[model samples]
Target: MSPTTDRTIDFTTGAPVAGSLDVAWVHGAAGEPNLQVHHYDEHTVILRQSKRVTYEAPFLFLLFGEERALLLDTGATEDAELFPLRATVDRLIDQWLERHPREGYGLVVAHTHGHGDHVAADAQFADRPQTAVVAREPEAVRDFFGFGDGWPTGAVTFDLGGRVLDILGSPGHHAAAITCYDPWTGILFTGDTVYPGRLYAFDFPAFRATLDRLVAFAETNPVTHVLGCHVEMKRRRRRDYPIGATYQPAEHRLELTSADLAAVRDAAHAVAGRKGIHRYDNFVIFNEPGKADQLRLLARGRLHQALAKLTRRN
Candidate 1:
């Protein structure tokens, strides 16, 4: 694995090559198979919230180094004890510690952006010893990373001992949104910026710039995978789950490729400042809020809920 050499696909289709990576779609504490846990090498793990929990099935990532472990974006789950997020994380940390055998391991809990779905489970990490939560506000994030003038556009490195994660300035989807590149695994974790779901660009210009930045970074770096938080797409291209669908069968894979990034970038560019949904090969870019569309969606959700209630009662 040289710096100049391009990284291979690593693994294709369903899963990665046996030992290098493996994903298990296990049941949450509530007995729903909505949580997906992935072992991306020995140092990194990716956990996803299933659609059964909510439509905003966010993904939480854990990166372990020699000194400390970093968990990114606690999913929209409110109960950590029931979800057992920290306990699950503790197990992962303990395993990492077996080899290093440190008396106390430090943990930093941070968010990709200041959105409810991403930071809903923040309370889980609040009281834990040796754990710190990076504030999600734009100013607080800038202060914590010490980016100052380069707040949203600058890059900073989080050194978890030997491992370093480079955070790229990513705004648009949200002011505090960021993209994390892991040199250890060659994976870029893009929060809500680009995923298989509805790509909402509250700030169209910033979103476009962020997409361009990602494309450029992928070109310069050997990015094996472009990982996002949610999987709203189906196995079929250009298709996605609608709002308020609790269960999705035969969903899309959780990872996107570099070529997918180029496609996503083109899609975002197509909708620059435009207020509508523009479809691409894998995703759709939305520029602004649509009141009419929102009303229709709300009506449909209520109708669906009414039908469900009747069926339960019958």
Candidate 2:
């Protein structure tokens, strides 16, 4: 099927609406980074954390389900100087629970990887006996907080009453990167594997393999909305950033199609043939004197271009 843009619902009215949410970017204490959250619908929220000075890269969170809230990826660390953000997120989660009381509705916190930006707030949930952490690898679970078991690589499903989340392992961005799909909402929470800005791969080969898996998953799954761990505020071409970003807040709606996947595969092949450093967006990634890294970057770029095209076309 061809890629197309779909209408997103407004969180406040719970009605399908157009246009982006108005976000407020507020700086934390002592010139700490700013954070923003956008609520696309009652069930979906996207939280973004902008790096202090650069504002170049920002962390994102995709929260889903009402009573049994499932957090896709947590924002970057607010440790030391900027600890208030952590409290803010905690309070937000608490408010969500209070607003939609779910008795014995345990919180499920999952991460894209072990990166500090994504998993730093993990300790916050340590004391919450009702909260559980899910990871794709045991080592990641252990590395982050020394708890929980790894999720299987194949398709896995979690039922949240009226909402159902399907977990698919996509390892390209990180060895442990995973994507969550909500069938009812047609939302796909792609960790670092696929986002708005540049794609970073610790191991190019693994990243490409993971992308391939994702392509297959997309082909079989009915994904209408896509959320990434981060969105390039500049690339978004928005006038102002939002304030008080909430959990499971929605931002950019993804356009995934078979043609887009094919383009990504082509890019991966091209990267596999290059040598030395390859420039992508802002930073230059070292290709390890092999074609593997290049291949992965190419695949990432291709997927990105395809999505862009799909968005414009729609």
Candidate 3:
């Protein structure tokens, strides 16, 4: 089939349908002003936006439930100008809640990692009593800029009155990275562990393990929609590039399956092995000694490669 030049793309038909989800692109730099929103239902909405970018960062999502809302990964923050994006996101949340008001609404800000781009807005919402900074590790919460209160790891469920969100600890991209799963919508709010493009890895071995766990989870759970933290296009004119302008909701036709997770794991392992024993040892050191600065460059290289390969393959 010939590719359509029309801006809108539909995931359901895997074609460029004129009428689909209403997605507006807030244009800026290559990765700047990366914001996108998907209104799933009257009570459910998903908003993904970029805060800042040293490199192309993932788009963050806001998942609204009946009683409360959850933010899946906040974007980058390299400069001061980008800080306003947090307020923009907050406004969006407020608007969402205004449309569907509940008695006692709360906000749950979670992260895929401790990266600046993904967790920049933690401090912004720290004072809100209804808001809680949830993560897979207690350190992640304590270390967060805005909200420094600690939380627990493993699988924790947050009740949203009508629906329950299960936060699963799937460390690999970052030790504190976790994925939010909504059983009712079949949507998995995957931070960086699984996205449309490449997957980053701070620790290759642990990353692979996390991918394996995700695959296993998919086998038992009905996860039809894998909502990624970031999805940007390389070339706008390319047939595969879905994101036309920045902040636009790029409709991903790719259906994530267990096999996809396995492939990512394999790719990560392959890259880790190619880096040789010394590099592998470095990851172990970083993991054990907590000497992140020691392996900063190496980790960055590995993460870049892992993400690149994942993006290319996906």
Candidate 4:
């Protein structure tokens, strides 16, 4: 297959096909599906855990290749009865196989990072045959991704048959954090690192360097959307829903552009030495937040929940 200059929806050679992000996502509404699956294209799928099921409501990605499919982040819940993530994924793979039938198709389970909310349901896929579940620890990630001794630098390529994804070692929000870029659709899966909600920089120096790497990569690549695992911001500028809030009626769009990535990079530079939350239009940076910061944030979330309960009662 010859590489074409044009990047239109050419699935024959694994070119990215565009899909809608305009669906009404499950926002803790009654009778919502445990997991909402959106088919970005014939080979690419986006799944979001329902907030009604868990407050994290993290988004997971399933990208199909010629030989195997890649499932990024098992999501936030462990119970299959409540989350049904593995079941949902199994069904999806079955359906995809129906269209593109093959024997011995495998599944490679990996993550954007190893945070509790992100890697909780990994147990679901542990016993599934022909599936390789990558461990969430920093060392495991380093080994699986072939990061070598250059722990938090450089980039590596992972091939899912013909579909090759560029994986960059991104740390800041979490030490083992990474960012993935798909050339097919030009979507960058950033996980919790550069999402719309609160950006928690547990390690400021590393986080700063990670953003710089991301910004430079986006500049060189044809990135269509910069997507994170969660959407924590509201529709209003510089405003975010309280942490742990189950229902968000006015959540911001999940996709961010390269320009938005640059904005985040610039903001990180501006608050180099900051030790607390710095609010911005698209995201809020919690640079090396202290114990007090976490408690206060938790308190605000509790208040939000209380007010929501009262309003519902009224």
Candidate 5:
């Protein structure tokens, strides 16, 4: 199916509107530098820290607001002394701020979840001026969004000047995973919950509940795009890189449709009690059990066995 809106794939190969992001997307890691920027609009820019630098291939989002821009998910590498992600961000922000030099715009460095791939660069933004790094701790994120002291998750709205972001605390994938809804663009950033990759369910029940909440929330809201942090699916569909594979060739699009979300919900509910991998046309959903289950799953192949040992070491 064609995209509902002009997205950042092969929609074009040229410049976009003024104060808007270019639709050009990033390709492979070879010859690609760090912090590859894909402009979506004046207010939205998607930054990809190449897999060559970080194997996770995590996408960091930079959202510009009248007050300040909010950065979601720092890259996996933590060499601030060399990489200096904050400095790269500042350089881009400097150019963006030059457009409206008189207007005051601060920065909020936040993460989608506390996984090492997403929050590895948290240290870089800790002491930046006019910038507050929301603690990776679940409680700190909950407090900042006023979700209260709950075990599971809840919803809250964060006002970023003219933009109002609906924050859905999604636990299950990770204890502090979140889904950020940008009302201005009708985009739902689902972190790892519904990404086009292995939907790793560390907690099956929590993941199911979160998907239900997201479905209901989308029912009431105008959601056109379900954007996730990582892209592990091959463009050919039903294919993905092996576990821990660094470079991705023929990578899938960064965005998923609501129908895709429903498919995920269906698969998740179907595999509610079962613990294994469920392959789909566009993605794969895997429910990870405990250590014993991991070893059992790994017994199938020497590669899997070696991966299990490496995973244990990490």
Candidate 6:
């Protein structure tokens, strides 16, 4: 599906509308705000940090419920002056409250994984009232989500009032990685584990298992779209932007489908013993890459940066 601008939502039935996601998100331009917020629906907000502020430019999700809101991933920056994530989130909550008034409404700040770029802004929510910022460690995540003895094995349900999410233990990119499925919207938020970018399988076995699980779960569920935290791939097939390239004018769309998930699983299975980058049409999977692989990626990123600078001068 393509990026949509029709953000009309039926609040009574809670049917989500396809919001505007086709616009050019922060392209490292001057005078842009640190964060960009988009409403996928009335109760669902998608926020992205500006690449100018930080190259990571990770995407964050805020889902409102009857009792509380779940803010997934704080962002890539910690300095509130630069990112202002908490302030921005507060304004969003207050605005949302005006429409759906509630007392003692709480906020649960969580993550897709324990990556630094995803949890950097956790400290900003520490002092906020009625807010519980879930710790980045695996133990904290498992405990808060009530993952029981199965730990990173079983699936659990988290009730956000009328909105209930199916939480699966998806550990590949990070040991604490999770894939949240929202029944209300039929959108699966699959963090860094599976996005239209580099799929870094630090633990290849766990990652493969997670992909298989996600595919199977989607088959039995009403999964409309598979959304991830970042967009790094270009519009071109089998190609990705350099690691640190900020201005992605032709970046791939953020939303992937269930078919894409299956494709990723099959591709990952095909490269079970591979130890390097496995390029696909939409995403690239790095299976147990070494330091040399990282260094090469960094070098390519630097080269892209230099080329961008030279092009600007000419």
TM-score of each: 0.86, 0.64, 0.63, 0.94, 0.84, 0.93
RMSD of each: 6.1, 11.5, 11.0, 3.9, 7.6, 4.7
Candidate 3: lDDT of 191? 71
lDDT of 5 by residue, 1-314 (tens): 23332222221223222333334444453566766787777668888877657657788898776677889998788887635688889988987766645345688888888888888888888788888898888888888778885535678888766676889989889998899998777788999899888788998889999999999888888777888988888888798665555556677888888889888999899988788888898778877666775564445444644675798699
Show the lowest summed lDDT stretch of 10 residues, model 5.
7-16
- Give the top-scoring candidate (TM-score): 4
Pick out the ten consecutive residues of candidate 3 with the lowest summed lDDT: 277-286
Q: Give the alpha carbon lDDT tens digit for every residue of 1-314 in model 1.
A: 33533222222233221224346453223576545677776667888777666667778899876667889988888786445677778788877666556656799888888898888777878898999888889887788767778879888887877677788889999999989887777888898888877788888888888989999999988787888887777778888666665555656777888898888888777766578777665887877658865675568767766775687699
Error of 1 at 7 (Å): 28
The better-scoring model by lDDT among 1 and 5 is 5
For residues 174-261, what per-residue lDDT tens digits would candidate 4 score against the true structure? 8789899998888999999888899999998899899999999998988889999999999899999998888888999999999999
Q: How many backbone clashes does candidate 5 have?
A: 5
Off by over 4 Å in 6: 1-22
- Sequence-dependent TM-score of model 6: 0.93
Candidate 2: residue 84 Cα off by (Å) = 3.6
- lDDT for position 50 in model 4: 89
Q: What is the C-alpha lDDT of each candidate?
A: 0.76, 0.53, 0.55, 0.89, 0.77, 0.89
Which regions of candidate 2 fall more than 4 Å away from where they truly are? Answer: 1-33, 53-57, 78-86, 134-153, 232-262, 275-314
lDDT score for residue 178 of model 4? 87
When 2 and 6 are scored with TM-score, the better candidate is: 6
